[model samples]
Target: MQNFLNLCNAVIGEDYVLHEPAKQAPYLQDWRQRATGQCLAVLRPANTEQVAQLVKLCAEYQVPIVPQGGNTGLVLGSIPDQSGTAVVMSLQRLNKIREIDTANSTITVDAGCLLEAIQIAAEQADFLFPLSLASEGSCTIGGNLSTNAGGTAVLRYGNTRELCLGLEVVTADGDIWHGLRGLRKDNSGYDLRDLLIGAEGTLGIITGAVLKLYPKPISQGTAFIAINSIVQAVALLHLAKQQCHANLTGFELINQLSLELVHQHFPQYQRIFQQARRFYVLLELSTYDNEQVTKQLLEHLITTAIEHGLVEDAVVANSIAQAKNCWALRESISAAQAKEGKNIKHDISIPISQIPNFVQDTDAALQLAFPASRMVTFGHLGDGNLHYNVSPPCGTDQDSFLEHHAEINRIVHDKTDQFGGSISAEHGIGTLKKQELLRYKSPVEIKLMRAIKQALDPHNIMNPGKIL
Candidate 1:
């Protein structure tokens, strides 16, 4: 152990190697406080070369490594194990925008670049990087790629995996695979770039990536609509798609409970409507065309939906500030839930058509089991992903409520299975959902995943005990 520490210190400078408990504690624990771990040391590597060397040394010494980004992951995937044999690798210093090819409509960036930073960079170049989330200011692109994160824009831009065209990775044996090509059409061998994007760093460490960009929208339309039920919301979604066509960029669903939580926590964010309905949708559309046409089209879509009884009432943002204010309501859900109490969150997805059935059945089953629980449902309705979360009764002990996590998960995940939905939609299978992945994935699928893991990280040193 002493020899291993000396090697790491020598390679990454003594200052970059952390040993004190207080200094390393932040890296070993997750942001949500649901997981805490112990590590022998936390190593900050500045670039891909340093990462390759550190991984090589760790591979030779048989020490495990956990690649962490901003430590903002909902799952405990980035946290180290309690054995203290693992080295936590932080990619914070590798923050750089390598290239921006406007002709190719792509930008190459380092793994540690913040998501919002990338968005700003693209905007500076007069392009758009549509991958966004509530944690855009904190979450790094490396974590986003590793988890294949999805946000409101996924309905139009797709997940991180679909946005990425190439990747640079450090294999478990210390080899750097430079696959960062900006080409859109490359019929190569097996798609290794796709493999590393959503593998949760269990297969290899992602160092950099080439991501797709789009033309900045010249006109934007945002609206908040009163929703009656999930079925009605889905119908409104279909109607909006037909009206807006490819210009529709976002379609989000929010429940009354979620909105109430936001109202309780963030009073300054005035409600979009005077009277809140049972559900709501924060929808958006954009186009490169003139603003007048976009505004007229938005108004027409809302009018048609309201006339059909699909929407009870609606409020369209008349100004940029109003649109931003409307967005704050959707972005504040997670923070509001945290302030409320202990929550059992399920980031699951199913066929877009079955969402209504899934929600009705799951809510009924959960209500029968725990009548006191509150279900806060909201997500990207266009892509069929819902962050269906349950908060314990107002006064239930946090620990006692957490004890029912497994049972609560069973009830929700079982319903998800009945609807043929995935257990994890965007959040990867970190320590939090390992067993769930096993139960949901088929034997052949699991075997194939294990085989790939063995082939890339034969020693099981890269993010050991994660994903597969």
Candidate 2:
């Protein structure tokens, strides 16, 4: 172990290698405190060559490696195991913008670049990278690609998988696979870029990528519309999409419970409607037209939606600040829930048509089993992804409530499966969902995944015990 540490120290400098527990704490812990891992050291390599060398050393020693970026994953995927034989490789230093081709509408960036930094670069180039999240300031493109993150803009642009043009990855064998081409149409042999984008670092470490860009929105309008039911919200989404067409960028659903929590935690964030309703849809539209025309179009849509009984009440943001504040109300849901109590989060997705039924049945089942449980449901309605989370009954012990995580997950996941939905929508099958994935996926599907893992990582050195 000492010799291995010495080799790592030589590859990246002693300053870049953290051996002490105190120094490695930040890299070893997850964002939600759901996981804490112990490792021999946290290695920070500067470039692709250094990363390849470090991976080669780990391969030689048969040591497992966990590729982490910004350490903000909710599923504990980036956190290392407690075996102490693994190395947590932090990719914060490889933060560079390799190139920006406005003509091709692509931006090439190192995997370690923060999402916000990428957004800024795209804006500076008079383009837009639509992948966004509340944690963009700290989350890296590598983690985003590894998990195939989806955010508000997924309705218009797409998920991380769709936004990516190419990827520069370091495979388990310590060899660099340079597939970073900005071309949009390349139906070559195998699509390796898609394979690594959402592999969660099991097959390889993503060092860089080529991401697609879009024209910046010249005019935008945001609104918070109160709805009477989840079914109404879904219907509202359909109507809104039809009315706004391609300019419809965001369509989010927030339940009354979620809004109450946000109001409780972040009092400064202005409330959406004057009176609370059963559900709210935080919708946005952007186009190349002027703000007045966009705002008027949004107003007309909201008026029509209200007349159709899809919306009970609506408040359109008059300015950019108000729009951001409306988004703040949506983005603050998770944090507010954290402040309220321990929650069992389910990033599940169902067919848009079946969302209303899934929510109704699941909520009823959970309540019938545990009469006191509370559900906070909200997410990107346009993409059919909902963060269906459970909070323990009021005044219950948080730890004791957490003990029912398995049971709670079973109920939610079973309902999702019945609806032909995915148990993991965007979070990926990290350590938290391995057992669930096995239970939900068929034997044939699991076998295919295992064969791929074994083929790429024969010794199981890259992020061992992750998806497979």
Candidate 3:
């Protein structure tokens, strides 16, 4: 172990190799603080070349490697295990924007670049990178791609996988694959780029990527609507799509309890509606037309929905500041839930048509089993992903309530499977969801996944206990 450490220190400067407990503390835990791991060391490489060299040394010594980015993953994918046999390879120092090709409508960036930084760079170039997340200020692009993260803009821009054109990766055997080509069409053979993506760093370590960009919208509109039920919300979504067409970029569904939690924890964010309804939809539209045209279209859509009895009441943002404040309410749900207490979180997705029924059935089943358990349900309605979470009954002990984690997960995930929905929508299967993945996937599917893992990482050293 000492010999391996010496070699790592030699490849990257001694200062970059963090072996002290104090120095390695932050990288040893997950974003949610659900679990803390122990590592032999935390290695920070400045560039792709140094990463390759460190990986080669790790391969030579048979030491496991955990490729981490910002350490912001909810699952325990980016951290090492309690065995303390693995080393965390932090990509923090590899922060750079390699190039921006306006003609190709792509930006090549290092793995460690912050998501917000990339968005700002794209805006400066007079283009739009529409990958917006609540954690945009902290999370890195590498983590986003590795998890194939889905945010609000997924309805229009799609997930990180769809946004990426190519990737530069370091294989398990310590060989660099320079596959960063910003080509929209390449039908030569199997797509290695897509394989490495969303693999949770099990196949290879993503070092860099070429990401797609878009022209900025000429006009934007945001609205908050109060609805009677999930059924009505779904109907309103259909109506909005018909009226706004491709201009409808976002449609988020927020249950009453989620809004109450936000109000309770963050009183600064004023509510848009005076009276609360069972559910709320934070919808947005972006178009190439002017602001007046956008406003007129939104007013027309709202009027039509109200006439159809789909919307009880709605408030459209009259200014940019108002639109931002409307978004702030939607973005504050997760944090409010955290401030309330620890809870079981499920990032599931079902067919859009089945969502209303699925929620009704699941909510009833859960209430019957665990009475008074708060359901903080909300997510990207347009794309069919829901962050369906459960807080303990009022006055119940958070840790004690968590003792029913396995049972709660079973209730939710089984229904998800029954509805033909994915157990994990945006989040990848780290150690947290590995068993669930096994139970949900068929024998043939699991076998194929394992075969690919074996072929790409024969040594079982690239994030060994992740997705597969």
Candidate 4:
């Protein structure tokens, strides 16, 4: 460990290597408050070359290397194991917006650049980099790309995997793969850029990427509506899609429990609707028309939905400020839940058609198994992903409730498997979902994943014990 630390310090200077326990403590834990681990040192590399060199040195010593970005991941992919044999490679220093080509509609950015920074940059250029999330302010593009993050915008723009054009990666063997072309169409032999996108840092370390950008919407509108059930929410989504078409940018589902959590934790947000239903849909409309057309269209859609019995009540944001406020409520769900108490989170996805049944069955099963638990469910219904979380009952001790995490996971994940859904959707199978992945995946699928890992990282040093 001492020798490795000395080598890292020599390569990147003493200021970049953190060995003290106090300074390393923050990097050892994940955002979920789970899986704290120990590492010899945290190394900060400034550029792709530095990253390549660090990987080479670690590979030479047969030491495990964990590539981390922003450290906002729900999974323990970035945290080292308790063995203290791994080195945490922090990519924060590599942040740099290389270029923004308005003509090609692409933005070249280093992996360490925060998602919000990219969004702001695109906005400044009068363009849109559509990959967004609640953690956009802190989560890095590298992490987003690594996890292939799905956000509210995925209904229209697609996930991180679809938004990326090219990549610059540091392979496990210390070689750099510079495929950062801003081309729209490339019929190449293999889409290597995608292979590393959601690999959870097991295949390689993403240094930078060329991301796709779209024309900024000239007009925007937002609507918050209360629905009777998940089935009604799905029905409304289908209706909205048919009516609004491309203007329907976002369609999210929020439950009453989640809304109450937000209202209780974030008092600044004014609850718009008087009555609370079982579920709510926060729908957004955007178009090229820079006049009142967008608002008129949104209002008409809401009115139609109400007449069809799809929506009980609705409120359309009157101004840009109101739209932002409405979004704040949706974005605050995760944080509000955190402030309320400890809970088990599952980011799962099912077929659009099966969502209603999946939610009903899972909620019923969890209720039967853990009678006192509260299910705070909400997510991008348009994309079939739901943040189905199980919180401890009111006035109950969080620690005691969390003790049944394993059993709770079995119940939730088993239900997901039964419905042909994924245990993990947007989040990758980092350490958190490794066992679930093994159990859910077919033997052939697991074999293919292992074969790829062995081929790319024969020593099993790059993010060891991850995905596979």
**How much lDDT does each candidate structure score?**
0.92, 0.93, 0.94, 0.91
Candidate 1 wrong stretches, greater than 4 Å: none
* Model 4: per-residue Cα lDDT over 1-468, one tens digit each: 678678888889999899889999888988877679999889999999999999999988888999999999987888999999899999999899999998899999999999999999999999999888999999999999999999999999999999999999999999999999988789978889889999989999999999999999898999999888988898898988999898899999999999998999999998978787888999998899964998889888888888888888888999878889889999999999999978999999988889999888888888898897899999999999989999998898999999999998998889888888999889888888899899999999999988989999999988998887
Q: Give the clashing pairs for model 3.
A: none
Off by over 4 Å in 2: none
- Encode model 3's per-residue lDDT on 141-248: one tens digit a residue: 999999999999999889999999999999998999999999999998999998888999999899999999999999999999999999998999999888889999
Q: How displaced is residue 298 in candidate 1, in Å?
A: 0.6
lDDT by residue for model 2 (399-455), tens: 998998999999999999999999988988889999999999999999999999999
What lDDT score goes with residue 73 in model 1? 92
RMSD of 1: 0.9
| Estimated TM-score for each candidate | 0.99, 0.99, 0.99, 0.98
Off by over 4 Å in 4: none
How many clashes does the backbone of model 2 have? 0
Clashing pairs in 4: none
- Tell me the lDDT of candidate 4: 0.91
Number of the top lDDT candidate: 3
